[model samples]
Target: MMATVRNPARDAVAFVGVGTTPYLRDAGGKSATALACDAARTAIEDAGVDLADIDGICGSSVPTVSVQAALGLPAVTWWSNSSLPFSLLVIEAMNAVFSGACTTVLVYHSSLRGAGGSKTAAADPFRVHNASDAHGHNAAMTAESPSGTYGYCAWAQRYLDTYGVGRDALGLVAINGRANAARNPHALFREPLSMEQYLGARMIREPLCVLDMDPPVDAGDAFVLTTAERARDLGHRPVLLHAATSGRTDRPFADQLEDYTISGKEIVAWRLWEKSDVALSDVDVFFPYDGFSIMALSWVEAVGYCQPGEAGPFLAKHWSAGENRVLIDGRVPINTHGGSLSEGATQGAGHFREAVTQLRGDAGERQVPGAATALVTPGGFLWNATGFVLRGG
Candidate 1:
């Protein structure tokens, strides 16, 4: 039995507009700020809302004030610059609209290839100066540090060891994303990736190959949000926020975390389901962050799609060998827009955008048929983990 919890914000706010810049492997000399502005303008136009209507701005990496100024919004009464993974900003903006802090909000997330991203990025003095680890953390990454690559590598090995699964578990995720990407014009890698290629890809970290990791890229994704009532009268079909929340554990540090099972995704899933009328069975599409393929595998279990250690069989059971994608029970599609693995990492912004696109019936070739509800688990199973349930009316 589960205790019923009432959430006033449930279905009160919605995503009315979504926009994206090309998911680029090359920066093309565009700065992160420029990419943000580009996406914001596109979202604003997509919403068909006048500039004066957007009274709030929210995002990650880029300051809210900076985005407001770049877009030349007359003024914004409320703004917030949340931390990485981007879902925090989405929740903040939704609350702001519901609380009367702002009527309509513009949210954006932008990523630039820093010096550490690639040799090409390193050649640019601008990128070099702003260099940080894969996740914008300036810390020196190493096997000694259980964050970024190290954390996932250790967790992946544990999952494999404990479950007696093989590369097929993680490889399916990569192959699925690549197959989906083949139809996504905005994807960074649109070619089909085979299991043979995935297993053969040079190992960056043992047990995790280059294919298992998300590549760094310069990109941006943005959304226009407002009260569900207001959204219904806007440019696109409103994707209501059935639930939105972020999570963290007492052991905030990656090393302090007990193990794979004790982390943020548990809390995120707990709160999300408790607050949502839409259950796991009702979800028409799913987006699990693929910053690391292990994170995606962990999410399906944490969210109750399967029991821990069953992800391998669960995935294998649902995989469409013909299409090379994972379709849950032949009804739901996972990450219709390729996901971070092949779509280029936009933190979790791209995941949300793709969800909204599918919900609004605007995903073009990648659209899930009659997708009405989408369950998105973004960020990692760490301090930044978050979840959202979106339903189209």
Candidate 2:
């Protein structure tokens, strides 16, 4: 059954706090819960609010209860205790906020599994087919990749055949991320990436090179959500959560998708537009998921910023170190914090934290000037996606 639970809208829900453990490829000294607590503590302090006010807590589905015990999380008004992706947790956290069950909400994720560990011999059954893959990145599939080990490749190859997308087009994506990551201090890969390096990178899946996948990393991140009115009392700037949207159909995976070119993330844009007054042109920054490069391009198109099949050219023609027309006259930033592909994946919570940073004007060197509006997205598996358009109002 679908988790279509909806919470009634309040006057407004705002993100008053955000925090994270330093982004690291491997945090050997830190346990996932330790990172999670650090992030949660930073958020609580940043908001200048006490934990007593936060009655609701939602978390990414890692294999631990330390987060619950650490924060003394009360019974979650809307808990998703499954291996659902990060985007789902954000959507559910918003639901709890809207339900009037809690004025302040803390959402967190921490994990060591993502820290470059090889899957054990008796790994999760889902990863059996992907064990021999060049890299472990694609050793599992979301609902979108129904072919299991080969589903992401299947979708990418279809995009190439139908759209005539060349291997160079994929290079364009890596280049965009690499350039942005270079400016991101929190990013793991801060070095410059050339087309040669990206193209020559080990092939993970047939069409997806190593550069296209997110490197495994260990870390944690957290966000605090409360009403705009309540947030006003807090010391931090409140980035209004204009809307939170989730979309899916009753299908199993990519095999059942009606259109290979259109995924659930595209549908999230449609829902985002339906709920907010923000226009596509008004978006100051975009934090679309960078778990995979192809998905990032798809989200750019899905969000209506560019037409379908136009992202390859958009990134190739417009992105450069000193020139990026997409954001602020070649200076407007995207994924300024480098995102999952470069910054390291913290079970998707990383994206949400970056969005908060941009909104709070705390994004250090990569900060977008006068960035009052930002869009954050998390997507995976077929038809499973979440969207948030945050504005500093």
- Candidate 2 per-residue lDDT, tens place, 305-367, comes to 677667787666556545432353354455666667777755467777777778888877777
Candidate achieving the largest TM-score: 1
lDDT of 2: 0.68
Candidate 1, residue 211: lDDT: 87
- Each model's backbone clash number: 0, 6
Q: Write the per-residue lDDT of candidate 1 for residues 1-393, one digit (tens) a residue.
A: 245666899999999888789888776888788889999988889999999999999888777777788788997889888877778889889999999999999999887877776677778898888653338456455556676567778778888999999988999889989999888888899899888999899998878998888888888889999999998788799999989888788886766777778789888899899988889999999999998898899898989989988887899899887788898898788888898999897887889999998998988888888999999999887688899999996
What are the Cα lDDT values of the candidates? 0.86, 0.68
Which stretches of candidate 2 lie above 4 Å from their native place? 1-11, 62-65, 73-83, 114-149, 321-332
Best by lDDT: 1
